[model samples]
Target: MKIEDWFQTLRSKAETIEEKWSDATEQERLQLADQLFYLRQVSDTVVDLWLQFEERLSIAIRRIKQMEGQLPVDDKHTQVAVTNETSDKDSSQSEVASAPLKKGKESTSELKEANPYDPVFRRGEGFYHLRMFQDAKKCFEELMQHAPDWESGRLYYAYSLLFCEEQEHAFREFRLLSRSASSPTVVASSFNAIGCILAEEQQWLEAAQAFKSSLEIKTDQEEARYNLALCYLKDGDAQEALDEIEKCLQKDEDDWESQMLWLRAAQLLQSMDESAELAPPSPIQLPTRDLDTDTLQEMASLYESVGNYHRAQICYHFLTERLPREGWAWHGLAWNTWLIAGTKRALTLMKKAISLAPDQDDFTFSYGWMQLFDGKIDEAVRAFRQMLEKNRENRLGQSGMISAYEKMGEYAAAKRMAKEFTEDQEPYVRSLGYFHLGRLAVVEENWRMAEQYFQRTLPHISQLREVPIYMQLCASKLGEQTSVKELLQPEL
Candidate 1:
């Protein structure tokens, strides 16, 4: 069937479903919900395919037009008539496309002649909107160098840096602009940018304050309000998040992100109400009005270390929500959730962490470990290899590679990696090397060699939980009950 016909059929189906939905019984409604969910997924897939086809079709048409340049005419009289007709049609179409840009450029030229600043700033804005970050950056940098006090140039320069992922430099520039910009709107925007940077660092409280400051300066700054709501959600204040998001929805009901956030906040609030025992304690009075970032981080770390995973989850959730761009926050949350929610859910969170910061060796190493635990040896191997390529000295990456190779039954590669790590300077690396070798020895049923390798590992990493387990197993195989008893002691 034609694409249009298929779409029309889907539309009719949707209309029928909608018509039935209002009159349906509760049981029927439940069944209809499942059908609707599946239908939405199918619709999304079809839309994506259609968009891809449209893009390809447009490119083909452009190529054909280029190839069919200057069509020949049968006679001179016919050529004249055809040329006149075609020229008029083509000129009209060309004029329509170029008119807005041409008029804009004319007005811009007049403004530039009347003003002291160069017209390149406006050109840079056009490039920025076109997503040409490098070109925009160059223009803004040149403008800033020539007119150092120009707030707009500095603001755009910082934005260009931000889009290009020079985050640290962008944060510094934004901070400077926040303090120095004479215009209130520019200062507010600078504050918003600063809040974004703080959020990227997982400083939720500080980010919220930054957004609040921006809102105070520019009351109608919708972006700041939305950001503040996100910060509230991160901080586990569901009611506050709901309230902020509701205000956004009130302003624009069709905003999909705000709608989603509103639902999330409402659900969270409902869950909190349903599980009274799981709710957090009331806030304690502090000497200061607000907690510092360092204090909040320390509390979160302490909770995680003490096995208070629920509390740790709250802290990490706040961090991740406030600083969605920060890979470490996501990784921390994944680890905390893994203790309670199991590997599969944690794996999804870990993947999000990896996507946000692919270059972070630690995040990549953890992702590989999770993949390994999920029995995805090939994927784990690829992740480990990628991490090792970025930082060859990454001990976790090397350890993951050894584990992945062992799981894949590539004993030779695993043994080679074990030998390489055993010779490394770091005690932890050497310990891991010995541990892998001991495991391999056990696999081979060489009890004596396994016991010896485990013994070697013990001196370097006596506190390691797995080391004692392997030591006891090897000793049991070697018919040494005394060593097993000693290794099994609680004090040991």
Candidate 2:
């Protein structure tokens, strides 16, 4: 459909959805939310396509306001471009006619002008946007054959190669472009792309050099700096990593990834056991106390997610100084301290958090888990039971209770809870169930049963790093000569 028609259709559909939402049941409301999520994805994809459709018509899509959306078409933009091209052609033609033209150069220009690659290029781009990488690669491959000097076509071809898992070919092509591309922007991007590929292969030294080349070309290359810092960290230059990430934070202090990297670098520099393992950073606090509340909260949460509990505790400490009465700040601080320091000191903090926010289930759940972690079986079981009494559907409470049961040597109760968890809707929960079952089997010296349980877990959530470690332990018990050579992880 035309742009206007599409816009109107979207607006009408949005308004109808909004009108239905107020009166819809819970299930229907959830269905509507899914619909909106998919629609937003479609909108984002279309926006990306439009940004690449033409050089001048980039602002065709903009942010929504209230319930309305706008997509302005600049008709005059195309007209002006065509007019300027024609004027330039006429001027060039006159100059050529007046002067003694070099026939070879003229013929070369004519050959370029006559090349039938525009449609092929556009088709390749369409396939690229639709995520049909093989088809895009074929089209771009044809373009490369016919127009070998076309850098844009080569760039697209490289991207398609990467998308198609032909990373070696993509790396070679990008490296070529990085050294020989006419456009500064393309050259910088090529270097960055090369760095990413090398970084994935764990060639940190080469990757860092590539990123440095990208930075030399474009001084404001933030992504290159981020990549370079990661490379530096991996290459055993924690000080350089810290310095590079500091530059990123200087430009954008709210960059949570930069803060995480900064925290990581500091941790590495201070750690005695600086191997491949990701340990929490040292100094226990940030150098500056000038970060805003939201930035600090996000940094803390990010650190928590990545298991840098020490860094999270540091953020929470700063937060308590600013928002002492906030229960969540205390709760966050309490958990991280328990994780990094000890449960003894964290117990008082957990109590304070509970007192301030008695209604928060997370605080209750953590309090229970902390007790369980500290080997206070009776207290942990009671706390978990209390939480479940208030809300039986509490997944955390159920999980904690199961662990408590296992600790208390109540195999029957633990097995029952784990069986229920196996029937849970979420696959991750099912994996957890199997994991607990496997743990129980290990405890009972049922090696074969434990192996089967962990094998079942692999299909559900293979990415959980602990699953393999447990499996390896089980294997060793069964007298199978196996070793964990490497733990493969998705890189940043």
Candidate 3:
């Protein structure tokens, strides 16, 4: 049977088992659970086998193309080899005529081998390891023309380019690799390379952004943190610089660059403090006192906006302690905690926020969304319905209801709620409408309509987890290949 048909039959059997197990004896339920576990393992094994088959097929196709001379050759490398051969044969006319013949032989010999374990690649990598960057660059430049999708070879080529002081070429190569590479380490390293290029050009803000992107992908990159701190110092944001440097020091206390940068930032802050003490207070300055809950709340919002979730969590934590009745403080704390902790803790905080502000549509809607994220679909539906009763125009509540219904397999109800929000002016709300409609189309096996709806939603909600996967599935059903690797890229 086809994979899709087999999946449909398996799903029907699973549903039947679930229905029977719900009313079964304890022993029967235990047997059903064991069967379900075995089915899950079988499903995982099938997916792994499919992925392996796809990889082997891709390799076979590439080899066939290379054998047929369909792959592009490196003309620069070929021309240089030809020119040298012509120079050696200039003394004899007969030899010169045969030079063209010799050139063809040389060209064919110089062509990169189809094997991944080709000796030339190892030689190039050996040269790179020995710090012979120019030689390595030459080898990689030729290798890339033959195997452009070889990620490790491409990354080494970019690194060689950077070491050779070809910053522009290196930056472009790293940027391209970051977009195409699936490994988080490779993507983070690429961003780090781009950051180094920007830093060398004295583009502090851009460099900071690049370093932040790198650290977001792989937070253990101490080098990226040190570079980010240096960029912040260069931009005169001493506090932020100090904070980043302190984080680096925590990871590696003996890191010389981080240690020096921390001292410099500390001195700058101290000097600013001394200068403030010597100068008269500004007319607009507020009276000196302990920070109030309102001040802490504002600071938390600012920190959260800048992706400083740890600091935001601290501020919100203090606010919650100082003003226990403040629902907004609890709400903000939940969001900040959600970034640092997981959904369960965030759900607990959100519940407190909703209880403190029962009339607040935002709190109630957020609670419902949290419930949806935690897989409490029935509870989420009830919360969303309650929110909708309180405020009929709540876009988030409407979207939540549609999502809950869709998750529960209530396609008709999901479609009805989706239609109600389809004309909403908000971009996210309208996007949710198209998203649920696409999901319904998928259930109905209408691949073309699903593709159309997903395309409409992509511009507004491309970041949704299910969007890229479903889009790729639809494309596959239509006999087109589409990469969905970017959807799995890690973020802060």
Candidate 4:
């Protein structure tokens, strides 16, 4: 075969190896390891072949030199072949030697480049996990210098800065990333970071704008919408807040966090409504009193800030009714009324809330909870079960459904759900499940079993002034008694 053809084959193999290494996953890397070994073998074979050819050419040249001295003249074809042989040897040796040298130099350069920045990235990850934000920032700064367009790295760096309480710098970085001519995901993520930062700073209007930008780019982002709704609430734009939360609920219909945020925002709007009734407007607007909705909204907020849920609810109720289409007033009524009347009345108010804002997951969940509290066991069960169908991980819906099942005397179903729910690290919900089991035993006149459940409640009743009375009753019924006086003894 011609040396030129052999060189072309080597070049093709090198190019294939380069391509494989350029974008290799773990599985691909394992497969390419074998290919790499085969390439090395071929390279070694080519080197040996070239060396042998050079050796033969060198011997022939020496013999030619001796013969030229012995004979008067040489054959033309023979002289030409010797000259060609010498040229080929020189060319082949030069190419072969340069090929290995070039590869070694490239490998060394790549290793040096990687070594300088790899540790910085690794340190950044470690510090981030440990919540050492300031230390993480230094590493990320190094990484940015090495790979400025590294999207994931930049995002982590921005978060580190935010966590370190460097909001201004983080905002600048996020702004840069959002406007960069890069992947759309980077832009969306930057907006998300900006929204979070603005929310933390209580810059509600700017935060809402950032979250809106994020949601427009990626509509399924529940956190962004939830944060946006919170910003609207902060800015005294209850209607807008309600709308954003509903959008979030549409994306993740069972997200309790988003649901809670919406419910709370709705409650604020209701407070605004109630305050409108507390104090009548003067026949003429006061010069000092700003009549903008923002200032008007503050009246209900002031009542709430004073721990007066009654007045707050009253004010929110009035403000919300004026805009009957707005759901926040009804939500406020439900939340405040529930605080006053427990779960039963809360359910009715939540129904009103749902009527005003039919698509809100938060109101729906609260309504189901009210039904559960009202002992509308089957209806509560149905609502929560339906919610779980949309999001299997919905913690509140699952717990509410389980409680409904327990209330319905489906002890086996309730027990199954309780077991699943209790697997969470926070044991309060799981303990409540146990308490419910004990109560079920009591209703069936299983005094001994009731005593067991009542006993379980003892560990969780520090905040309850009446739970011990029930515990005493359970003990008395079971004839394994502790007195109310004994149960109520103050903790040392």
Which model scores highest in TM-score?
2
lDDT of each: 0.67, 0.72, 0.68, 0.61
Give the residue spans of candidate 2 off by over 4 A: 1-224, 227-257, 261-275, 279-287, 305-307, 459-465, 485-492
Comparing 3 and 4 on lDDT, the stronger one: 3
> Per-residue lDDT tens digits of candidate 2, residues 107-146?
0001122246756766676676556779879998999998
- State the RMSD for candidate 1: 23.6
Q: Rank the candidates by TM-score, best first.
A: 2, 1, 3, 4
Write down the lDDT that model 1 would get.
Answer: 0.67
278-338, model 3: which lDDT tens digit per residue?
A: 1111221221225555556555654554445776788888888888998998998998888
Error of model 3, residue 69, in angstroms: 83
What's the TM-score of every candidate structure?
0.39, 0.50, 0.37, 0.34
Q: Which stretches in model 4 have alpha-carbon errors above 4 Å?
A: 1-116, 274-492
Residue pairs clashing, model 1: 234-318
Candidate 1 runs further than 4 Å off: 1-292, 303-308, 482-485, 488-492
- Using lDDT as the measure, the top candidate is 2
In model 3, which range of ten residues has the least summed lDDT?
97-106
